[model samples]
Target: MIQIANRTISLATEPFVIAEMSGNHNNSLERALEIVDAAAETGAHALKIQTYTAETITIRSDRPEFRIEDEGSLWSGRTLFNLYEEACLPWDWHKAIFDRCAEHGMIGFSTPFDDTAVAHLESLNVPCYKIASFEIVDLPLIRLVARTGKPMIMSTGMADIGEIHQAVQTARSNGCGQIILLKCTSSYPAMPGDSNILTIPHLRELFETEVGISDHTMGTGVSVAAVALGATVIEKHFTLDRAAGGVDSKFSLEPDEFKRLVEDSAQAHASLGRIQYGQLANEKTSKLHRRSLYVVEDVEEGTIASSSNIRSIRPGNGLEPAYWDLIIGRKFAKDVKAGYPLSIDHFF
Candidate 1:
């Protein structure tokens, strides 16, 4: 189990939900604070930001290859540099954002895209660092982040099992003992079918570390299902409004939606219950509603119990139905009245 900001995060407890405010701030400090407040109100335990400048993430190249060429992508025609520039949160905003999160009692952390970003976040003494899905293959960067000795969370989006093993090995080799692997789908506005949430338990078995989900799907359905499958943490993009035109706004959950994710994820986790079951504590009183043997009509002494006089009915105060055959041919020991609960001694 990994502890973050004094919170014990593991598969045993309910999922720790982190609301990622990545680039959804729209470059405004005020908006960033609002995002933090809104996420906190959603009962999310943590709020995450991305600490990277465009220059740190990529070069200023304008070549056709430097721009996204896929027509289906959200940033289709935009150059990577320009897109990152617009999406990047300024370094100066980190202090206030982190402070506000502390004031609101939420864990504040971020994903470091480069070595410099890691150093910058380290100076702030951030609780943990997250490695974005795109950077999973960047072994050197992962090593640098791991060397900080803080808990590290790596997202597995486009990575195959072999690549993920290499990343996990790199983090462990570089001195990071507390590591969390998140099952992720790289697509923006990912579809439910592509999420493959069932991989959560498998990831835990494969890596022998905490496993979680960094969801991009439309609703809380994916997040809740992930919890049901043993995901210990859930990270989802958050925005004040999806129609506000931020870089990740389209796929991010608004305040209400994120709140639902937090609530429903916890509920799903609680519903897992223990392996053995007869009746839960809350169902004790309701157990009386179950069917059992009872007298349906009046029968005098020496009367043979028959289908007409005895029946399996509700209000389970009578003999168990499992003894139905034995009681059917027996004679009543007393004058049983209609609607009376049958007892074992009533049979002679």
Candidate 2:
């Protein structure tokens, strides 16, 4: 189990819903505060942001490999440095954002890209740290964040089993005992077929830690499905309005959609009560409506019971349906009325 602030996140608890406010503030502190308020209003357990500057994440290079030329990418034709510059949240804004989260009773944390970012978040006494999918291979950064002894949530997007093992080993050796692995599809606005949320439980079993999904799918379906499969944490990008247009607004959920996610994911978690086959309390009353052997027609005393007089029917106050064949040639001990429930005593 992982506890962030006062919230307990585990397979046994309700899903820990996180509203990732990544660059959706549109560079305005006022807008950022509003996003925090909106996120809290939606009943999300926590809010997360990215802590990095353009210089901290990448250099100003015009190399072909440094540019996103994929036509399928949202930032097509943009250099990595330029995109980071536009999307990077200012370090000076962390305190205000964290303070706002505290005011609203939400846990505030960030994804640290380097040693400097890690130290900065540590000074703020952040409760936990998240490792973005792209940074999963940065062993040095992982070790630095883990040294804080805070809970860590790492996204496994493009990583294989070996890479995940290395990252988890690094964190454990460095001091972080509370780790959450989130199955992630790195594509922006990820497709449903590519989500593969079934990995959630496998990740928990493989790493023996809490598992979740950093969902990029358009709706809450994937997240809810993840909870049913043992996801204990759900992180999705949040934005005030996609129409307003920000770095991640295109794939981010609006306030109402996020609220639905919070509700639906919790419902999905509640539905996974346990492995049970016996009738439930609510089902006890309905059991009477199930089909069982009943007398379909009136019969004189000493008359032989058969298909014409007895058969399986509803209102289960009768012999079990399994007894139907055995009772077929038995003589009736007493006259049974039409629609009467057949009992073992009625047969001789």
Q: In candidate 1, how many clashes are counted? A: 0
All candidates: TM-score? 0.97, 0.95
Off by over 4 Å in 2: none
- When summed lDDT is taken over every stretch of 10 residues in candidate 2, the lowest stretch is 316-325
Residues 121-148, model 2: lDDT tens digits: 9889999999999999999999988888
**lDDT scores for all predictions?**
0.92, 0.93
- Candidate 1 residue runs with Cα over 4 Å from true position: none
Residue 75 local lDDT, model 1: 92
Give residue 325's error in model 2 in angstroms. Answer: 1.7
Which residue pairs clash in candidate 2? none
TM-score of 1: 0.97
* Residue lDDT tens for model 1, 1-348: 999887899877889999999889998999999999998899999999998988888899989889999988899999999999999999999989999999989999999988889889999999999999999999999999989898999999999999999999999999999999999999998999999998999999999999999999888899899988888999999999988889899999999998988889988988887797687788889968999888999999999999999999998888889989989989999998999889989978
Model 2 residue 224 CA deviation in Å: 1.6
What's every prediction's RMSD, in angstroms? 1.2, 1.6
